[model samples]
Target: MGRPSDIPVWRHIGEAPCPPSGQERVTIAIVGAGPVGLAMALEFGRRGHQVLLLNRPDFISAGSKAICFSKRSLDIFDRLGVGDAIVEKGVSWNVGKVFWGDRPDPVYQFDMLPVKEQKRPGFLNIPQYHVEDILFDAASTLSSIDMRFGHEVTNVLPDDDGVDLEVRTSLNSYKVRADWVIACDGSRSPIRSMLGLEFEGRIFEDNFLIADIRMKGDHPSERWFWFDPPFNPGQSALMHKQPDDIWRLDFQLGWNIDRKAAVAPENVEPLVRAMLGPDVEFSREWYSIYTFQCRRIERFLHGHVIFAGDSAHLVSPFGARGCNGGFADIDNLGWKLDLILRGEAPASFLETYDEEAIVTADENIRNSTRSTDFITPKSETSRAFRDAVLELAQDFPFARPFVNSGRLSTAISYPDSGINTPDMDRWVGGVAPGSPVIDVPIGNRWLLDRLGNRFVVLADGWQGPAPDGVEIIDVGIAAETLQLIRRRFDFSPGAACLIRPDQYVAARWRTPTPALVSDALRRARGLA
Candidate 1:
């Protein structure tokens, strides 16, 4: 056994877990080195906690899965130190066109970011591998994060205090003790199975083909989805542009087709040519046939061990919710975990993580299930209804809401979150309490840049000293930014908002007293 050459920080198979006095005992041990786990490690590290990342494979995830990153994910990456690079390397797109039948034009087009003033784009199209590399590189530089590739978790023993993990590397085994173990394992979760947990939901009958090809073409930087196109008739198709002149094209193949033949070169070649025109030249980079399932464990937390990302829940890839939702899990859990570890919050706080995150999961699964039904009609009556909706969507504005082209991923809001202290004043046409704070520009700096990763007070014309532990925004430096803030928050002279560490609104007031802010902070921290 020897130290891994790739990562200088960790011993792949050379040594077992450190002794009681050994330096390897970490505050958090995250299983799975995928993007979610990597970000999870970085998040804890950023909050001044030590994390050990166990990656089963040697960082070789195939097929560029989960290409689209949403704004919430990008915003999180900004704090993690990889946002600018990803935005520069990926194709930034906000417009989506949905085409139905043989129309050379779309039935109707939608814009993901109608605001046009946010710091990040509505979506960034880049290979998931690129995101992993960037996140890993960032995590490696931090002294608090130790990433071990090629390490598998063979056994897990949980107790009232913490969990003991048995990790198996290529040629050796090690036992590690962690105060907390967060499993970011993929859908076929070994951690979930090892714990005797199961995901309860339906598995859709239809299958889809993913053809990722490299080519040079004039395709605009936008998302295009087609229903029953001439090339791929009687089925749905989606097209997206990625970095390095790569394109992702997905075709819905009905149930009962030969999975092997569907991905064959001869069969895939015709589909690509038909969609991209007869004279288009391209080479296949990767081909995959996938059957999607929408399922989630009834509970995400099992005492000291918690499941996250694809391990806890899975949704059809239609809404790009797969990765974005995982990022959401990291954002919600990191601060709470940090607080609980520092003895700043009660262990009961983690229950809110279970409740809030499940809210997000249920939202994503419901949309994924509906999108699957619309894209792949199971019955003739369903097919007719889908067609009629699309036809009307082309001409009628109201019908457009019925047209569901895999409704793109967006950040989730917990309107009824346990942490929220309801509005003390009437509000309308603004970001709601318990929803994520809207991103805006204030003078030369973005609002999110000012927010950082801490609990804060966003004040507009409030005349009071800053509360203890909570930072005050005191914004509106520039004239335009001031106006934008006032409109976005619907504020008066003494207006203020209490925002949680994850940039979620906890409470707001048209006018506030010092006692109210303190109570809100305590409640948001799960102490009240």
Candidate 2:
């Protein structure tokens, strides 16, 4: 068959067992055009490696999936140069209200864990579609990257030198060859199952229904979790405000109910009324019922084939960790691929991808799982404990933290990653030394200002040249930003930190001389 205008032309490499004949070879074959896959493709292409991005033609769909982007995830987008567009169209929410067991007033009215400037913008609620569009657009501009919209992967076969892949489109089957294959195909990932990787986790007995509604109500845009919801005892609903006055409502479906019957207008209208009371007008825009299961792949990689995003780990969306966790996977895998492809590092450098991410993925799973349990307790004892704790929260402010059904924190630090030292005294406000969030001001500049380039090391005390290849800033903070930092973080003028490309603190020291800062940079880059 004659090649279509959009059909990718392949060039041949040495004989490989998987693909008998392929005209083209690329460094990597990334499956799925979702946010995670696009992120990986963007990073690889920007680093001067040949990349192929493939997805089934039917993959694109309307409706927003995830709406919240954490600082850690946003930081990655910043590096990709698409973060500003995402932030521009999204709503920033810092204060989340938590109600305890049918209480009229929220027991916990606020949390500021991932503040933008400590006292400013924190988390933003932008639809997942907007983020994907930005990343996809950025990837499309790179000549090194070839994006195939209708392509579907039939098989991935790894050989001694690289991986062989079979892709099927409408008119023909194409054999493609790549040095590595990264699968971001999602939770029910065919590639992961094909690899015989085990996904271990319990499927929750409960189901939740999410609907986007155009409701004129008094609901504040801030996240609101109704514990012990009146509509259904032992269950709750989460409400988030999206762009264009659309409200995203998530309701817990009681076990044994026919999932289809619950979404009928007859059944849904009453629940909305009960939750909104008599003084609201609303109509459903879109709706879905999801049964969440917390699961993670036993291994992040098998030979040259690797897993990421929902393909590698699945989590409850309680803290917006699901896609964000996958985004983190892309960030971690991106630079490492650059290093290995450039012959600057050994392939073993890629091993840390599994080490740091799998551990972080498991942590995210655990945190989201606990949030699910707190909101929907399965056993009598746990229910009683949950109730008693909420009851006590009425009288005691100390017990208020228990009402946190959502683990809303801007930073998820890997304190144990050899890159972070716990004894570092620079961290204040109980900041995890490993997960670095800094505040830098230069002529009204703020922390996270101009951060999307690469790993940065902040040297406050040392008046010396930074390492040969890293970005260094002598953060000269204005008095107001400094005051804001003092209120938000505990850092002295002499402290310095080695931040990773993704903005997490690789290492820090209380009294960092040039020598110590240099060593930290070396250690962070695995040079030490």
Candidate 3:
């Protein structure tokens, strides 16, 4: 494919001598250079694993694809060393307003960042290209990540012990063996097709036009959604503010519209002018018509090959679940894959990745499906119900919950996973097994910064020494700190909680013993 004349080309820094045939072996082979693949590379690189990251394209992405980054994704980026840059470059927003047809007032408004004290904002809006650049820069600086741009994977063969890949470059074709292969190739993954994997789910007939424009406007940095608005009659519209004066607009075009004509400048300009006044000057950055689907493969793990991000599952773009869920995949798979590669954990531990990620994908599909159904009613009765909800939402506070513009992606809680230790003692509202650690401030640093990438034993004022391979955190040193800890963890003096490397709580006890802690660690690591 030829590059667009107007788009700027990113420099390629992956030029190097090709490896000799049949002799190259890496601990891991990643099949894409998008956000998920780059993140996988960065995580493994940081852990000192031999990694090869392959991409078919030599240049970076030209336009913003995934614009919304959730707080949980930011936390993952922070752990990978690029969180601050993303936060600094993206437009942070926590408030959203939803309006009904031609009404001068909003029917409902929501605040995503309800709490004042937190490490990251509720979400940020930035072009996906910027995120790729940051991850690419970080990946290039690592010694363990071998980035091979313009190298395409032609075939893959998985075996009991490892996988063999046939790759083609402009110069030559070569074969490489890897202990593990990760397919981050994308929704139209060739690896998936080659492996005869099937993605099963519902495909919505509704089409939407996405336009990114650069303009100077008075619109505040918040999400504004319209249900049957004046600008686009009888359909829903969404507008969001992004960094660099770029604004994203999505206009729903019922399935019958011609996609090519919808994205044409002649048609798109009139829509933009209608929405943003005829006098406002703006230039189009990018435009595309997309049909969304809520789909996923039955399994994410296939022998020695694993799939992440779009290659594993896909969701409608309403709730920003696609990228956020992909980040979750990276977080869940990174440590587990690393441990397995280093022989610290058995290969069967990967079954937990499949179990947990499937649960996450299902949650995303459910929310995205609901949002799609509400936005595009399939029948007259459904439309009437939706309109009725919107109408009542203007006056009745009770009707507001029925409005589902988009739930906005948030962390999914895994309370009943097999890895978690069941509660044996009476406890009130607090972090439980399989729950991500809540962030809290300690003196000058945050609680997350103090926790290591291993098993952690957090205690209020316990004097007993922790078992081997466990890091202890004394939460009772300061009165104010102790108060915050107790409120978050529902803890009294001497209570302890065991936290996993991914920051999920594994177990808690009023009084912990070495035997109990060790057993909990074993269960959490899938060794039990």
Per-residue C-alpha lDDT of model 3 across residues 252-275, encoded as one tens digit per residue = 988998888999999999999888
Evaluate model 2: give its lDDT. Answer: 0.73
Evaluation by lDDT, superior candidate among 1 and 3: 3
**Candidate 1 root-mean-square deviation in Å:** 3.3
Better of 2 and 3 by lDDT: 3
Off by more than 4 A, model 1: 1-24
Task: Give the top-scoring candidate (lDDT).
Answer: 3
Task: Rank by TM-score, highest first.
Answer: 3, 1, 2
Question: Which segments of candidate 3 are over 4 A away from where they belong?
Answer: 1-16, 477-479
Give the whole-model CA lDDT for all candidates, comma-separated: 0.86, 0.73, 0.87
| TM-score of each model, paired residue for residue | 0.95, 0.89, 0.96
Question: Tens-digit lDDT track for model 2 on 1-528?
Answer: 122344222221111122234466888999987789888898888878899888764334456487887766766777776777877888777778877556688877775444444323567887777777778778878999888876778888888778888887666787888899999888878888777779998788887888778866556669888887776566788888887778888888877889998888888877777877766788887777788889987889777888999999888888888888888898888877777777866777777788888877888888888988887787899888888878888899888877757785355567777655456463556345566565445446557655554677765554556677777665554455555554444556666667776667776666766676677766665555
Query: Between candidates 2 and 3, which one is better according to TM-score?
Result: 3
Per-structure clash totals for the candidates: 0, 7, 0
- lDDT of each residue in 1-528, candidate 1, tens digit only: 243354323212223342343324567999988889988998998777889888776544656489999988999999777899889899999999999879998886888887868899999999888888788778878998887777788998899999999887667677888989999988988989999997899989988999999999889999999999999999999999999989999999889999999999999989999999999999998888989899999998899998889998999998899999999998999999888998989999999999999999999999989988998887999989999999898789989878888778888999998889988689886777789988999888899888998999898877556578777878756467788888887776788998988899898888877888888888999999
